[model samples]
Target chain A: MSLYRPPRTQSSEITPREVYLSRRSFMAGTAAGLAFAASGTALAAPLAATPSAYKVADKLTPKQDVTTYNNFYEFGVNKSDPAANSGDFKPTPWAIEVGGLVAKPQVIDLEKIMTEIPMEERVYRMRCVETWSMVIPWIGFPLSALLDRVEPLGSAKYVAFETVVRPAEMPGQSGFFQPLNWPYVEGLRLDEARHPLTILATGLYGETLPNQNGAPIRLVVPWKYGFKGVKSIVKITLTEKEPPTTWKNSGPSEYGFYANVNPAVDHPRWSQATERRIGEGDGLFGGRRVDTLPFNGYADEVAGLYAGMDLKKFY
Target chain B: MALPALPARLKPASVWALYALGLMPGLYAFYLGIYGGLGADPVREFEHLLGTWALRFLCAGLVITPIRDLLSVNLIAYRRALGLIAFYYVLAHFTVYLTLDRGLILTSILGDILKRPYIMLGMVGLLILIPLALTSNRWSIRRLGSRWNSLHKLAYPLLLAALLHYVLSLKSITLEPAIYIAVVTVLLGYRLVRPKLMERRRARRVTATR
Candidate 1:
């Protein structure tokens, strides 16, 4: 067996009972439709993804806190802005334009992809660069599954993801002074994109993702900072070069492309050795502070991906 | 630069009322923090609001000197209260960071202060302000005499340190922080050119008298 354990399709306590029971039925219905033609519509039916074997020992963060507090700057810059201002954002009738060095480049509809891929519930620890964390039960499938459907060319070395730019719907995007450049972009090495731990999350807590929480689709790389999980992704381009990311373009010194969570790699201005775990305590007398782990505690699974490279330099 | 003559002095009641109004934001933030009105991450919000108010008050106090010199507004009487309020906000901000953000973890706090440039800068600004806050009384002015002016000059360093702390704390230097830095640059930049302006004024006055 390989030194690194690949994710198994087994039981993890993190999965909700209702979703677990429907897994067999969900798979049985996978062949019900392949409506690639239903691409640009604005309606989304209920979604169902299987419960994946990957999970964390930590308890789930309160769904209220998870949904209410977010970093989706497309809606707004403040943590609460996404939740408050995302009311007008329509995440449905969504389709991701997958192209660039691919055998089958197509505009994959949210519904079509939902039928083609087997979604799984993975409980992962999301560590933000701002030194805050949450253990979330995310419902989605490995990003490799999507990449596989596209059949990336051998020349493709990186996978660049772009969030949708609906300025009319997203207030943050419509404003004259945007906190970030429009169509916020993120990228990952092709190998990293194929890793089992990296998923494009669709829903959370056994429900459709809220608009503020990157509804319809968002990338989730457990080992990297939360920003790497680009939200409301509309464009996925397999590239021959490392693509420029939003944060890196905005602040090169403070934010790097890799953005892997390393306790040793301090963000020029702040320490990353510790983080406040949201919903861990009553948030009364004091907060629940915990030591930040390398690779966000997925080191055993992903550390090999960065084997000899200095995390401090990449970070 | 022409302006109407202002009142010789503001009534103490008016200054007292200004003090109450000035403190509303910080206090309201604290009230909302405890009541769950500040949203999911109330702890961070509370801490941020206090830090912002502290910096704002420090800037307000700094403005008095410039306004007096440039605009002929002798609002210096309110400067002491603004500095004291700024010191209070800083104290509250640190308390929230220690209790809510750090959970009173000594090791974590020490690590942050030692390793984080932003945290260290904030602490230095806090330390400098404490001496100024304590000496804001009339007694310090009577006793220190000329030394009092030199001691209060520490406000300049405190202002720089506070702005750096604010700028460094953010992940990206967004527009809000950029505006703060710009405002501060102008405030400090004015000091550099003030001597020349004052020299010109002196020459004009001498010629007019002659």
Candidate 2:
């Protein structure tokens, strides 16, 4: 036989490195597909921050509208479940502990947290990882305001939050195998922590925080999946390393620590490029899908943070 | 002494044909819901309609064996198809509750399960059906044999679970679930007492003839 090599593969053409990289990308793409399958709904419209800048609004959302929505599981499964079960959680006498690598570590009560920070009303679109989204006029102050009080040490690189845990009160906590720990935990990179979109939210639609909606205090990271914004906070820790997060601990590949709500990145099991907005009623887009936004369309404010990084690899 | 098999058309397609037609009403209800259909409470209407279909199909599936045995007709072929159809509607019923009603929230669903006995029973009913659905095939039939019969016997417990789920889910213990419970108990009791009664009757007839 003649010493002829395969035409498609030259001695230098399909290198092993190229094959490895392609395989890695394929695996990553599959993982994104899985994530999308787990959660995919309509992309929500971003609500504008009102000029009035009131600490609270008359009605953040209509009463009928409030009952027709949601996807927070720690609070419960039904859209109206959190609205009902959340009422049982006591928000009074709630305290926020600030410590760990912080120069000015101190504990602040709920009243002080609001007084120390100026509350602005922002109507931001809340998109769940599972794809359904809603536009809510949230009443809260920027996270930067709270960090200012903590005064992190030079070594502090990440900020961690812990949700209040009361298994007796929160029946969901009865099962030990709950993917998340008794209290929900979430974290942010130091720079991401300082972003303006990061709000330490208190109320929605111009009223006191509803129990189902993370009443006493919660984080609102507009660019990330809803879970990144932990609810019912009891502790805040500044650490040299990234903190353990609920989703990441449960399934690392499915829920990255960043958990940025990027439509471009497929979530392993489903496509993230589009979503279905629930309860809008039918017509052109009624019960239909809509295109997803990059960084949930807050790219103008948060895109620069990941400028030099390769998202596909980091994702 | 037996006649040769008749052609497909001559063999009664009446029951099968009627069952096939029953699917249209559900599809129509779903279609109506889809196209500006159920007015104010579309979600609730859809839920009610689908839940009804689940129960109806379940009762229909249960009745197949009794009718077949009493009439000495071939319903074994229809049983698999009917049982699967029952599963399909029930799956749809559960899905609407999860995605539409529950919004797919894990923490919240877990909470409801803990607080509501009705929700817990409904979930148990749903979970018990999983294996039956998995094994409802000829391949499994041949492979499993007597074990298959034993496993498929779970339909009795499943039906009870379903009735309990339904009764608990209702705001009041109305005439509907009570009727279903009565009917299903009689059916299961029939299955249990059937063979012994037939044996005693056969013995009495032989003694009388002698």
Candidate 1 C-alpha lDDT tens digits along A43-120: 223456676668776768887789878898888788878877877778878999999989999999997788778878
TM of each candidate vs. truth: 0.87, 0.57
Q: Candidate 2, A233: how far from true, in Å?
A: 0.8
Residue range B102-131, candidate 1, lDDT tens digits: 877798789889988889999999999999
- Residue-wise C-alpha lDDT for candidate 2, range A1-315, written one tens digit per residue: 111112322323323334644544565478664553232110111222333232221112332354335545565544555654554577787899999989999998888666656677765666677665655667788888889888988999999999888866665566543434557888999899988778888876545566666767889987787778788889999999999998788667767888877876766543456565544655211343455677776777688999998776555
Q: Kindly report the docking quality category of candidate 1.
A: acceptable
- Say which candidate scores most in TM-score: 1
Tens digits of per-residue lDDT for model 2 on B86-190? Answer: 787778878886666556766755766766666677778778788998999889999998999999888888887777777655423334566787887887798
Q: What is the lDDT of residue B192 in candidate 1?
A: 83
- Worst ten in a row by lDDT for model 2 chain B: B168-177
lDDT of 2 at A128: 72
Native-referenced DockQ of model 2:
0.05
Residue B125, candidate 1: C-alpha displacement in angstroms: 0.9
What does the lDDT read for residue A106 in candidate 2?
Answer: 92
